[model samples]
Target: MATAPAANDNARPSRLGPFLRSPAFGLVLVALLAAAPAAAVLLGQPFWLTMATRVAIFALAALSLSFILGQGGLVSFGHAAPFGIGAYAVLILADLGFTDALVAFPVAFLAGALFSGVTGTVALRTRGVYFIMITLALAQMAFFTFTSLSAYGGDDGMTLWARSTVAGQKWLKNDLTFAYLAIGLLALFLVLGNRVLASRFGRVFRGLKENESRLAALGYDAYPVRLVAYALAGGVAAVAGALLANQTEFVSPAYMAWQRSGDLIVMVVLGGLGPLHGAIVGAAVVLVVEETLSHLTEHWKIIFGPLLILIVLLRGGLIARILGGRRG
Candidate 1:
């Protein structure tokens, strides 16, 4: 009864193949992030807890960019405008006696949304390279606007006297608590983004990306829809900015520099632009690599530049492999 084994049997895929292909892979990424603070404590590397918090904040920013860029086909080079606006929202609010996250966060979100909505109304009217340039110009305008505000320390930047509290409690002052809070926010946004992408609105947004002409023919006015999505993305990014301000206890014009927006784009590209979770992975990888390289030498970018070029040359195969999916 011993039949010869089929030739194809040996080619059976590993169990990991399915897991990697499944949505659970994204969950695992989130779980690892959630565990980072505790793991850092266990290893006696408390600095890593701070690093994880930074990673989570940047991931949120990148995820927001991914929302508009990946789905709506709106590549905003001025995305940092909202981010910077958010930080300033916190700074202004705290200065005016609103230091609670409960208050500052919503204000930051609305500030970001308002800025994005106003600028995106014009920026989204263009397409291709023109759109990119407009966003860059708009963001630079914001950079200079902030730099000229001498009252908020302008070019020198300003420091927060104390971190924003959680509902009037100083709970966020604790490193571990802050790290977990950041991770929790990132997880919540990832879930919401996934849901949005699966909804009818997401379908139209995606259609706008694939063929706006077709969507237009179908009687969908792409402008308002794109504008709404842009504003939402900006709002989310502003929240990240608020979190960043809290984490560093500082706010500066540089927070929303054009370069920061470029970094967000890179993170989205590095993560393959398919799933929002990839932004989390991309943010972690970029920050960790930069951190490691800086300790080795002052001119980290010399190494980083070529390394990034190689990654781009490879067109994100490394990320795709790790994420267990094809790049979008």
Candidate 2:
């Protein structure tokens, strides 16, 4: 009798199980991304390649946020701190005569991870709105600290004299090569993020989101696991920041601003707030929409603010209808 019941349970799949398990969705997304550069080249629109690179960078940053916010339920409002720190890391290294990506990128990643680890130790002690406020405060402290660095151009920002080189080669100086590099990094991390989220560590981290008490009862220490996830997210966001620095050839204290963090949050939420791919979609849509709206009017935010609210209100139904899944 027990065997028959277990068989019946196994036979009946959850409503969203197929949608989640299907590879068609991810394959389509990857194919579309891989085609963008080629399409731009064939169409003779180099600007599109630049735009695609920008989208990829932001998507990577947003994906990092999703790793914590979506999977671990750690809402970090100060995410831009690590991002800006990464950008500045490149600038600082360049000042020290290290303009190679091989040298700068890893340093930037470590800087970001270190900053996140130190701050998350304290921030994780709080929960809910308190956590958000603490992160914002910590990020503001970083922002002010950067502004005080007159040697690095202070509040006015500084421009990179040259983009980082690839193995002492000037490959990154070419827009096409740089765009592909950004896309390649995004693809690599997307795979890594998926793998991390599927591992045992991911299971426990997500459990932190769903029920900390239950997990603690099961002999799990939430602090160390959450800190590791937070640090990893910060490191990834820093890499995106480094790419952004390369793309713009500029670094600013403004990158560490609370508003920048809010923009990151918007990207994650706009992208559907859970899946990493949603961050990519959200970054692309937000950038495209911002560009379009800016052309339409200088007061674009006046229109965008309400539009975002409406989307947030309707996102659940819209997503369920689009995915053809029962709303859980």
Candidate 3:
């Protein structure tokens, strides 16, 4: 039988590997993926530009989820609550004529912080399945609450007259520019996330995932650490939501539904939970498969269903397995 490595063996320092099998390679690949739309534009294919843009947007969201779910084993099933709140922040403010990205973006971050602050406090009191259920409940509450708001078009959702302006300029309305913006933000967040994961806080967070009791024995308080990580993840997810509103130009209560949260989890798992950028690969694969399948048939999910299962069974994930090399 294949046995897991000893803790000491797992603790050995790591080094970058071959181009085809390194985390650095995966990141470089992601950068090229970001540039793909520009290449498509050169080829006179506007449709691919739009699809690549969506990949950037969801990649941001799934990247946020990766911080907690992929890195620390914090299974937050309510990620969509903050994500949807971020979208609604843009929509509601735009409806009130506050369409500047500066104003709306901050509001979205605050909204996510608010949700995470309240629910995370309560959810952190539990662990395992209890924690998962609490997160789901909180997400559903946000969903239903938004659905009941008739002023914002309730369950039907609201649309924006125009994309959020940057410094009072309509830069994002341009498809190519918007794609670049999304890619830029994704890169920025990826850098920020890497710092967080590489820091002492991240080590402690991962330690808790392995053994909370042992970490506690070492004098680290899990509550505060977990709470902070959860809040940060929520804030990041909300930023993704804000960008998504600009991409879709719509906000609906449906964004916060439990199923969307599940999709985020799927993206994290599909990308491979080894490194942070795995989520990017997962997001692109999910969106591309979904888009391609949808065009082929109305019941495309039936086809996608088996395909996803086969993927899981065959390789678990593409980027983490191939680019990241064999898992420890």
Candidate 4:
């Protein structure tokens, strides 16, 4: 028995030999994951933690956009609609005395999925610029509808009196705990997204992105696959929106504004697209840059606007190349 145990332990090392050999890359990844949270905790700065939480939330939203734009080859300009809807869903639920995260989150996801299904059916009918325009229009419609809802605070936005509880516990009331929870969700979604993109369904989506007509000739229905992906992306974005609402303790039509949708796309592109992790990097970069630039000047847009153009022209392709070099 002792001899057998020694042999089994030796085999276990051999099984992991390849992974252990790639120590540098693994170590770097582990360090990167640990650095942000560790810094936040060590610094003991509430503002930095809040900013990091905001970045994670926005990154989750950008990741959702990447699923549709980068993978599904769907340029949806209305992505913010689901995000806003999810936020509003949480707000509404809180108002209705259902402030538990366990309840609010699932409800927000379902609402987003349902909205995506209905909106996708209409928006998917067109492709290219038409699709973009239609999505933008649909998002505008949603924004206007929200603006008219006087009961929910409408244009002025409603403040959330409290954050959602967890299983009758006020766990999320703490900013630090809530921030870690947001990070956990971001990591969870990223892993789930990676698995999804490697699955058989992901293969079909990639094929469709490469050539939809060829996929159809091969007896696959591209529309349904794309629609399902679109809905799933919307659902994920809605989850982010719910978190955002809880973080800010506010809900308003501005959440669904067209500029917000554009910002999401910008984050996706800046992060190099396709890879889920890129979204988080992009969000952090954009937010940090914006914060720094804003602090530097009251009219920072005067400087930031041209700088962004230069980045799009020069660094955009470089980012894509660095992040797997897959073009949409």
Best by TM-score: 1
Candidate 2 lDDT at 234 equals 91
Ranking by TM-score: 1, 2, 3, 4
Residue 26, candidate 1: Cα error in Å is 2.3
Off by over 4 Å in 1: 1-23, 321-328
Better of 3 and 4 by lDDT: 3
Question: What does the lDDT come to for candidate 3?
Answer: 0.83
RMSD of 2: 5.8
Give the RMSD in angstroms, all C-alphas superposed, for model 1: 7.3
**lDDT assessment of candidate 1:** 0.85
- The TM-score of predicted model 3 comes to 0.90
Which numbered prediction scores highest in lDDT against the true structure?
Answer: 1
Clashing pairs in 4: none
Candidate 3: C-alpha RMSD after superposition: 3.6
Give the lDDT of residue 232 in candidate 1: 92
- For model 4, residues 142-249, the per-residue Cα lDDT tens digits are 999999999999898899989999999999988888888887788778778777888999889878877788989989998898889889999999999999999998
How far is 297's C-alpha from truth in model 2 (Å)? 0.8
TM-scores vs. true structure, each candidate: 0.92, 0.90, 0.90, 0.88
Model 3 pairs in collision: none
